[model samples]
Target: MLNGERLTGTGRSKLTAALALAFLGAVTSVSGTSAQSAVPKPGASVFTTDIAPILQAKCEACHRAGSSAPMSLRTYEETRPWARSIKARVSRREMPPWHIDKTVGIQHFKNDISLSDQQIEKIVSWIDAGAPRGDPNDMPPAREWGNGEQWNIGEPDLVVMSPKRVVPAHGPDWWGDLEVDPQLTEDRWIQAIETKPVGVARRVVHHAGTTLIQPDGARESLSEFAVGKYGDIYPEGAGRLLRAGSKISFGVHFHSVGEELPVVIEVGYKLYPRGYVPKHKVTEVNVGVINGHLFDDLDIPANSVTRHEAFAKLEKAARIISYQPHMHIRGKAMTMDAIYPNGQAQTLSSVDRFDFNWHVAYVYDDDYAPLLPAGTILHTVGIHDNTAANRLNPDPNQWVGFGNRTFDDMLQCHVLLYYMDDAEYQQQVAERQAKKKSQTTQNQ
Candidate 1:
């Protein structure tokens, strides 16, 4: 069974019937045709007053023209045909692509784009009401967006391009390093960084992880570009240093498409003001298997569900900035837990439904980010389904193991850490406690 549904024989029939009834009930509830009055009241002028505002704030950023999403939701005329589809997607909590489990773990995030329950209800109600364009004048002003080539981190202080490479029409996957000089005359702290494939490169490039090589020959991970990752923006008072005479190295993985294509990667950096030093330096660590070989001991039987666990112990107190789970097509779910020195275990994050297509990096809000003491062990559990029930699974009959290709599977989680001394860690803990006390007092 996958996602609590059996995929074969009579089981599949039951699953289908259950889904149909759920969908029908949703439609009826929103339409006010059901006997149960527990459904939320339909919004007043939902399309313009309620639904449009939510889309403008959360969806239009990507759903606009020339954006990554396939359809535009800017105007009623453009969105009417997709109203039912939008309702269905939002009802399943699949759109906007934020997959963090709400019931468990830290709930505060700075970059959360998931719609609230009320927003989803409004959307469903709008679609059930025949998607009427309630009042032309009630429509919100259309959101303004930059052209497709615009940088997500605003104008960059510096831009570097990787050496161009060619991908043949058909061949095995290619992996190599493409290095380039940024030509910075002095050291600078990077506040934000973004990497993207230029032009045709987007089609054939699977992933490109860039590293910073300093003049002293020290290396540091800079940033990475993948399907679901937009970019990395350091939290307030925290930044990564990019020293002078540093070179950028890109570890690129390119797979062949149907047509030959040339690829180039563009890296953008937004730097802090001159002579500015951040309070903390962010360090990224991949918390996975100790040996760092993600699937070395993996043996997944055909048509079965499997689980794997990995652990990373922190030698110093650290504040975790973000959590990003990485897996191949067969990945189903992943959870991160923290075992404190006092032996108290708490889950930091749980992504119940892991969608390989969007490798989202959940940036924890400052107040709620995990603060771990020395010796805290981060434990990650990953679940994989290698059965026909997994629609993305290519072959259920074949045993699967780790390889570089897309057909293979691997499990890993990327976490950003800001190491702190005992004094600083205690100071932060005290401040958080004070703030929480104030909030509770205000509520009372």
Candidate 2:
């Protein structure tokens, strides 16, 4: 359990402001009926003429040529067959993959390819209208690619690489974790982080997350291990500590996607601390372990809808700073309510449709924030589908679990908070960060 000291009123209010959003809520949830309403058959020429421009401008970057996408939509011939796939993913708000919130105001990346409702509708209408390829002259110029090798800021001070893991030729996907030790050069404070593969190992390796060694300043290979799950609870020690001399043991996991090869990787961290005084502690609440009771598996049905609920009781002096809900492909919808001891309740998140691939953390504005006295129950309600439509549903007929490893399913919720008097925790953060810096410097 995390240090649960109650936050001060001023602390709660201010921390709420500082805990702004970290992702794009670009994906919108759509019901099966709504999804079907968005697609049109090949008779639509606008899908080739007008709609093609949208895909080229917003999607082709990652979906074309040699990218990791499952298929290529390089031309009308290639795209004609996947019209339904495009419609489903787009209507469900799954394409142009962006996770930041667009309903309220939020910044965006320069290369952001997310689609607006208007854009989505336009494509849908064109397909429905028999897709007129307007005219060749109407086609917008193709987007030029700039070198992406440049870092978001500049060179990372330290780079940690993992050992090579082998994959057999032609078989089921491999699920394994590899550890890395990055001895820091000097004590430092990191503001950002990124990871990449070490060599030409395309068939293996997907994504990775890490945890730092407690008190010892060593990195614990958490995501890699299958036996000892650090914890399925949120705010757990699932993060790697960063301090001078801190040794990092990163947990790397990859899926086969039906290919075979060996893989290695380098995870990078960017440091920043010059802007403002760090007072309130910002964190994440991961929703997991589901259903009628605590830590129990949910009994949901295939080709049906099931609702799961969870609550985190808050202390009288507590106030929620921000909230985020996560679920995989089977997720249909989600909502959060803050119920006080006095019976007053505040709605936190009321999403209509939940997209597993588009789930993200939602940070609310402090102006209209809610405060709860003791007995404040932060409630989360989520709807799920295990039908054939869910692309990631391994066995739509089979149910899954809440543990990490990605194979099992989860029906839980987390409420990340930033509270007052979190200075001590922040100090611990700083101490560990310093150790990471020292370790990086010593290694150099």
> Which model scores highest in lDDT?
1
The lDDT per prediction is 0.78, 0.51
Cα lDDT tens digits for candidate 1, 148-229: 4667888999999999999998887787799998788999999999998886677777778788998998776678886445
* Per-residue accuracy of model 2 over 298-355 as CA lDDT, tens digit each: 5566566678887666543343444445565577666777776788776655655555
> Which residue runs of candidate 1 sit more than 4 Å off their true CA positions?
1-45, 148-154, 164-187, 196-221, 224-231, 243-265, 272-279, 290-295
**Model 2, C-alpha of 171: deviation from truth (Å):** 2.4
Q: Provide the clash count, candidate 2.
A: 56
Error of 2 at 6 (Å): 57
- Evaluate model 2: give its lDDT: 0.51
Worst 10 residues of 1 by lDDT: 29-38
Error of 2 at 204 (Å): 5.4
TM-score for all predictions?
Answer: 0.80, 0.60
Total clashes in model 1, counting residue pairs 3 or more apart in sequence or in different chains: 0
